[model samples]
Target chain A: MKLDLQTELCRRLNITYPVIQAGMAGGPTTAEMVAGVSNAGGLGKLGAAYMVPDAIRDTVRAIRRLTDRPFGVNLFTVDMTDDLSRVREVQRMLDPLREELGIAHGKEDLRTPNWFAEQFQVLLEEEVPVISTAFGVLPDDAMREAKAAGRTVMTMVTTVEEAKLAEEKGADVLVAQGSDAGGHRGTFDITKHPYGANIGTFSLVPQIVDNVRVPVVAAGGVMDGRGLVAALALGAQGVQLGTRFLTSAESGAHPAYKKALLESTEEDTVITKAFSGRPARGIRNAFIDHVENSGVAPLPFPSQNTATGDIRKEAAAQNDPRYLSLWAGQATRLLTDGDRAEEIVKEIIAQAQELLK
Target chain B: MKLDLQTELCRRLNITYPVIQAGMAGGPTTAEMVAGVSNAGGLGKLGAAYMVPDAIRDTVRAIRRLTDRPFGVNLFTVDMTDDLSRVREVQRMLDPLREELGIAHGKEDLRTPNWFAEQFQVLLEEEVPVISTAFGVLPDDAMREAKAAGRTVMTMVTTVEEAKLAEEKGADVLVAQGSDAGGHRGTFDITKHPYGANIGTFSLVPQIVDNVRVPVVAAGGVMDGRGLVAALALGAQGVQLGTRFLTSAESGAHPAYKKALLESTEEDTVITKAFSGRPARGIRNAFIDHVENSGVAPLPFPSQNTATGDIRKEAAAQNDPRYLSLWAGQATRLLTDGDRAEEIVKEIIAQAQELLK
Candidate 1:
């Protein structure tokens, strides 16, 4: 009995395989990876987080040029905490380190580009098939708009409480971000709440399945076929893989970044905020090393991000490998040398089918 | 309706809950924390991972002086990969960084003292009631000797395969070290293994209970009475907590280490090898930050560890927070100001009773 990964995934996503090329921030989350996955009977997701409205529009257009297949867009829906005291405190503390890194350190205009609503409007205009958000639940109005526009809305949540919250806010699917997940957590309270468990897909998937009515998408550290079968057996409607795709030929990550991903093992990846003040899993490197060792404090999200952006960019440009952000998950070691999205899709589907039998 | 944590623990250990304060690796696994938890009718454990045979003897004796009650000692077993080539490669790779950290290079002895066998000899001589090994199962001779001497033997395993292996090796009890666990995983094949799952108390306890005939003790990211009750509800005979007790006043983690624990939120902790080459969860800090970014290849187990031992010791001695190995778990943020182990234990029991009803 071969598992119809595509059919099962489509059944769950209301699209094709319970496979999704996860949305990644920065460049690796390319139209090729997304469209390739989608074309191969899986969902490909474009990360629209931190993108300007124009960049998002152009990216959507670019994906459309490549494939007529369905794809999703992801954004950070953080409820901006009005308090700037902590942000200020963090900035004041990290100023010297920024100077040491030879990056200009002054008050970054700490303004969130009200790009989420604008991006949503653009996404609706483009008529993308799916939309997802991390950090918090999307507003009921936004959820209503997306659904009204005939798009499915998925939200990221780590805990059962957040799952319920997303559902209440009208999430069509729940992306359960485990602690082992790479990138920013879709957690609502990054500071106050602790990520609950080193919950493996086996344990967390079933519990979330038991708790929620919506289709559950198991994200975080899922790299290959065994993991995919395990997720489905544990009752996940689909498996969303981020780190695995980052090193694929279709990805647009810097050559150095992709190389680091190839080099990483299960032990090599770690969850750290030395890059962005927000917690994210990535390959251990020089930037992370310097920040973790420096007695200086880290600036809050965006500020700390903006402060170090130059150094990170320089490191990547120089192929320094050390300072570059190597965002990845625990399953990084499993990412082997591979081609673009379609081959990966076929490989995973075939192996997953084998495992189910 | 009250869940008897002690009774459940006793059933799992086939001993008394008043019997175990889980063995902690660093100084935080102190006589006070051990004696107090043991005194309160739960088993207290002395972390003997970093200790030499003589140190283990002295610490066991110290705990004996503090409490006439029965307690357990814990050790790491079988991390020495018999693959000499791989071991040599790892040591050779570590040479540069060792020199950078101002440590002697090319000691090349590569043999970490196999304290497990020696410690077993001391335990037999001293006649401790219970003994356990984390990471992997003890050798046949050690298990046989301990059991033959009327001592109870336990082994920690992170996966079912490992549990079965332990059972095959004649382990009397199994401690299920879930992925949420704070310390080094007792996984035998750290190189090729997938950390099974979030496998928290809820998911792990039941599965381990069903699969193995021996009693199961759940460990990892567990805190408070709610967690204890939940574990018991999932069929855990008992629960072992490291992070929760580490924050108690009875703990000997450096003041800075304790402070980091006290100040931690779920976001504050991440699994990293900035301390030991092995992945362990701890309060996020500069040591982790520096190493994470430096791209300096971390020395593998025992070697990577030996290289950093001086810096860690020096940092701890000088109370320089930057270099301290602040090993802790996600539960660090939940720890309140109270330091009394007895009070914490009583409160956990009391809270569990309240929730159980």
Candidate 2:
């Protein structure tokens, strides 16, 4: 059997394969992992959402030092809202957990850092090759600046409406993130509930591809070569995988978190707003269940996310995945133990080639 | 353009194309449409969930008269429960709409018809080549009888657990219906909330395929050849489509319903339990919004389904889809007007051929 796997995405990105290592926030996507994937002939993206300007520049420089291959940086465009009462309620709910974990209660005057602008400025200054935006649309000026700096702009969207808007606002690529995707949904409105637009990647990619002329990249629940080929068949030019790489040797995820993912089944993951106000897919644990059953509405994004930072940190330090956000897609079951980022890229491409043949 | 589109599903079902015209309940899938698709080299399925034993036998014979190609019959295996008070509540809520539509309020002793057993018997007696069970697993006895009669059994599942259970119960194939799939979800426990398992076809198919050795058939949000090829790449042996064929000339959908689907976009559909207690995807209309916003809980399956029957009838009689349940998948935007079932099968194959090449 002869199969044509080279897509427009590969041509535009100048990559050997249509697979992209997802830029997972809060650490799994490390500079080493990004460079490893890119060096192995697939595009890799640095998860720069939680990084400060200096950190972003350092990480980009580190990736450059590792490999001169084309890579991308992902940032979050979040709307900051102040709702102290809700934040306080969440803090109250987490009081017991904090006590149990021996962590200090988050301060009442807790503030979320707005680092997106600084990160964007760093990307331009560093002349990043590609940029991917999640949580919401990239600001027009930022998008323009990136283009001016010879960067490719890709906007992540959970719905076709957002895909159209991103295209209209000059997106070179659309990352159609499905509900099964790990991490926060790329729904444009941070204030709107994320679960309302629950279109899966299989359904989302084709519709987005049909509605937009730009190349579409399928994300969420994609774990292997079959997934990459499947996305291409759905009219997508490429696929972005996150969970499969969470356990990669170069990934920054805690060993316990990686172990939990490896031992888990597809049904183990749930979409919850516990770790963050926005819905995200993660392995279900005590913390998620507690927050859901607590009857306390979570504070809006960034606030709730910030409030839980201490808990997650302590959980990671203790090597306990229960209180930590084990962000992984529904396809976590497909992940294999001991696969390096470079090996993962090569294995996926090789398997896809054999299947296509 | 040459494409080897023959999949395991096609070989197992002995069909020329790896496509199955979805057995959409509440009309749209007519005997003529089923036969047309079968004659056109794709497996066509009769939506026999609402038919009595005699009607089922007659429809099977009617299809046999139209085409000798292999086809399938779909039935709902729902566990019915009686809750008169809840039924009355739905009736009371719809009283105003009933009067507005010049429809009579449902009778006090309104009871759901129990015809599944009789329908199964008809299927066995009629020697239906393929049997597809929705809503629940096919009983062991039924599965045995179907297999004894040389009938292939396909179970529809919304989750991987259900898929595993169905496979253990002797399912020859699995139809992995994603959340974006139109019509009632095939969740086994009718009492369990349907929307809780929000897996999309893209996400659901591969996971289910990974869990079960049986060939998986991808359903929901698939509208054309690209979708068919995509499902295959996801490890699905074939694809089942619903909304795409809603406007086929041979489809039983009302002209207004067909028009609504054709004019609609992907965002026009909503998964709501307003029409039936079980959540189903359909084009948003006045009825859905009214029932959803009315703050009244719908009665359980079969009861609420029966209570709203009159309003839907009246609405269809008036050619008003606002009141009628215009069931369609999220891929309604891909539907075109006036294509015949044969043309649809041919077009899908042709388009897929070009793309695969």
Candidate 3:
């Protein structure tokens, strides 16, 4: 018997499978990966948070060029202002590491550009089917525009309060991002200290489901079929995976970073704000340890993120994962090496379908 | 059609239902509650960690008097030493609250009595069918002794490393406790900072199941049938609940604490080290807020816990929950009021069984 694996989210998103490839920022998720997952019957998402407006359009076009299957775009609603003084202090702290990595360190350009509006504009112009916002809530006008364009809007929330707020703000779906999730936390308030509302996926999902009428998507630390079935049992309409796809052939992660993830255990990952001012779960390396133990607090958001970009780039070029931000979930040990995104999607859905049956 | 709800843990624990009511300390879990659950064909655990050896033996006998079904005893393997100076500081910090509650303030006794050996002795003498250890790993000799006595030994672990260690140490079962769990964390090292391996139930259970050969019991924020099914779907053999049972008729929790739980939301809970020197998840109140924002660090575990004992007592006596610990999981909002432990067990089993079918 072919079990009815289609969830309400599947019907609403016009996808065959109730699975989503997470829109992981800082590489990993690429147009090819997004298209691969979508083509494999799951909803794929383009991690276009770091891209300029033109790049976002290009990526959307690129994904469309590959697959006509519906795909989504993810953006970070980050505050683009930078505190130069704090950035300079962070740079001074990074001076030693920069020299070691053979990177030039001078007056770091700390200005953060306002890219969210432009990115959203690009998303609208491209007639994207889905728009996922993280790090902050999407503005009311933008959300209205997306809906007007016949796009489904989803927002990532770390707490039940955020879920309720997202629902109130007319989010078509809620991505309950657990603390064990890879990459930057999708907390709406960047100014407030994170980890205050670090509810895990199991606890976060059901509560969000209960609070919101919209379909809930469970994220963070989900790796395989068991996790997918568990999320559905917990009342989530679907499961969004990031780390599981980080090793996919279609992922844009550095080879060294993927290698590190393959070699890592749950203990190898730590929630650190040293790489970015915001807390994110990543593989623990010398870079993370040095910054953590350095006693200097990182400047908020974009400033700290921008300051570390060069170091991360250099480390990637050198194939040294030690200095790279190897963003991964606690389920890194469950991830297999060199899997194709399409195969991963098919396997996960097939396995979960078997289990559900 | 009747769904087969039998799991490996159900068979191993000799229970008809794969559910374990949490052994919450400082009230809530009681001998009657434990007996009630056990009588309903699920395993129940007496929270005897705070009790003396005689009290533990008495409680075990008391449960036996109510139900002939097998039950378990829970103990904390805590380090029984305190820094008097730090205790004094904590006591001084609590002075204002004590004064507000019209309680006497004086030199607080900071001595932490060694209770594990006595408690374990009681368990062995009583020939308790199951023994659950938290806070620290069960000593090798005690574990061996338990097995010799034909007592199934289980240890609570918050991380995969700890789960592996527990298996290596011959723990018959592994209780994968997540960060959202109520009361004190079950971390092995009291000296080590808490929340270091703060994996959530959804993320923690599957990984622990993958690492351990023993039956894994998922705990932390699991409240009802959906949570139970979710646990099983995630590869857990059973589910353990804390807050859900806190409102049971058989629970020993103060009426005010129960009321607070009934009125609480997921946002109302916060993980704070104020009540106990160790990190614990509890309902947020004026006391928690005051202590958290007070800038004075709490004394180590038992000492800090002991220092706040009087205040908690007074708060309960006054029917004021604001000053009480009000320990609860993040899923407190999902809890319903005035249910019997047996009914809770039966209802959860029935609901999950229906869902599975």
Ranking by DockQ: 3, 2, 1
lDDT by residue (tens digit), candidate 1, A1-357: 222355344764665678888788787888778889988888899988878888888999989998887889998886433334456555555556456556666464565445777887888898888998888877778888888887888888776667778887888889877766777777677665432334443335555665789988888756666556545544567788887787788888898888888876445666677776677777888677777777655655655676566677766667778778888776554676657788888888777666444
Please, what are the lDDT tens digits per residue for candidate 3 over residues B131-187?
Answer: 998886788899889998889998899888899998998999889998778877688
Model 3 TM-score? 0.95
TM-score of each: 0.58, 0.95, 0.95
Better of 1 and 3 by lDDT: 3
Q: By summed lDDT, which 10 consecutive residues of candidate 2 chain B come out lowest? A: B189-198
lDDT of 1 at B309: 66
Candidate 1 reaches a DockQ of 0.04
- Please, what are the lDDT tens digits per residue for candidate 3 over residues A256-302? 98888898877667778888788888888999988988999987777
Better of 1 and 2 by DockQ: 2
Candidate 1 lDDT over residue span B1-357, tens digit each: 223455534754444442245687767788778888878767888888778778878888888998877788887875644223344554455445445455565444555555566777887887778888877777777778888898878888765667788888888888877676676767776575433233333334454665788877777755666456545544557778887887688787788777777765544566776666777766667777777776664666655676566677766766677667777655553566656887777777776656444
The digit string of per-residue lDDT tens for model 2 on A1-357 reads 224568888889988888888888888889999999999999999988888789999999999999999999999887666567766678889988989899887677888888878888898889888899887667888877877777899888988889999999988988998877876768887454455366767778888888899999999888888888778878788889888889999999899999999988766778888997888888899999999999998887778888988999999899888899988787776888878999999998887786677
Candidate 1, residue B31: Cα displacement in angstroms equals 28
